[model samples]
Target: MSDADAPLSATPRTRLRRMSQKGRGDRGALFEVLRAGLVCHLGALVDGCPMVVPTVYGFDTTHLFLHGSVASRSLTTDAEVCVTVTVVDGLVLARSVFEHGVNYRSAMVYGTPRRVVDAEEKLYGLRLLTEHVAPGQWDYTRAPNGRELAATALLALPLAEASVKTRSGPPDDGVGPDAALGLWAGELPLVATWQQPLTDPALPATVAVPAHVAARAGTRADRS
Candidate 1:
């Protein structure tokens, strides 16, 4: 994708195009790819130097919201941000080592991100952030105190400039003459699943695993 701040096509022209198979154009495709991921690579510039960092993000239908410690440089500045999220589901095992590949879903967004500053909106943004991780956990846990609230920064990136790339199924060369070589040639799928939760040693058994946490097993975000 071009580094220009404008939205790329639904499937941007990139080195990975061969694996990008989404049929829809624009927003539909981008949203689908984004929804399939839990973490995103957020890119921005600080003092003319390019910086790309991994971060957790949440989204409403029209925008993506990112939050971090108030001390985080990425959220503090009014930089034009580019966020990309990718989720890999399998390793393509081919007879030839040169043809190895991974099946994945990805989305990239470009824009001048706006930081959310209002207290009410920030609280709502926090809910979007937390609930996006575990649908019902926001209300069950302790709400942020004054100190915690003052230490968090949130930025919401619009869906205006975004695109998606996705890949599925088996390797293209899996059925070539290499197939007769007797070498294994198929997809080795990777899946993410939640394990049991660990509770704080000081907490009593009366503080049960909230339904939100209990329901998270097998969730896509639980990807290992």
Candidate 2:
């Protein structure tokens, strides 16, 4: 990968003691981890106090974007922010209660976000955010009008200071005294799938589910 697209030199959750090996140092893996997730928690120090807020995030290969109101006390500032994304793949069922864990992927992105002011990039970023969630809705929906654009706030946080950590399969301690417990030990895999898209209540009676729209609901790891 090119340098800009490379993973962070450090793992994001170095301070979190559990599942440290899941913290990958490569940038590309982290991006893939983030892409697999829809929601993210944004952590930042507002006036030297820590704050954590959950929000929707969209990311391209190079940059991660978040949107909110311009009057947002936390997002509008020039201060640095920490963004984290997670995907729960499955539940690790261990033979013993103490050995249970989750099979998931998570990443934390750190950077001082650049407030997006360029009108073209703002619209483009919005499109990216739209497609990230509802892939085909951008072309079908009307473009943002002036008043709508005026009321929105967007921030671009560089996809840096990130890392990926994943856990899967069975408990790491399946071959000890726990193994003699006679309990069924294995992974209870959790699969995520997008259900069929629900039609808009305001949709015109003549409107039918387009192939582009219908395909989204059945989407899962099969597409990934």
Candidate No. with top TM-score: 2
Poorest 10 consecutive residues by lDDT, candidate 1: 2-11
Report the Cα RMSD per candidate. Answer: 4.8, 2.5
Cα lDDT, model 1, residue 155: 87
Question: Which parts of model 2 are misplaced by more than 4 Å?
Answer: 1-7, 11-19, 47-49, 221-223
Q: What stretches of model 1 exceed 4 Å from their correct place?
A: 1-26, 218-224
**Residue clash pairs of candidate 2:** 7-26, 7-27, 22-165
The candidate 2 region of ten consecutive residues with least summed lDDT is 7-16
Candidate 2 lDDT over 1-224, as tens digits, reads: 68546647554444447756666666777767766888888888877889888887777767888888877766844787878888888888888788898988887777889888889999989899888877788898899988888878888988756656777777877778778878898888877787876888998989999877887775784234
- The alpha-carbon deviation from the true structure for residue 113 of candidate 1, after best TM-score superposition, in angstroms, is 0.3
lDDT of 1 by residue, 35-149 (tens): 6677888888867888888987888767788989878877744667889888888999888988888987777788888888888988888898777667787888799987888
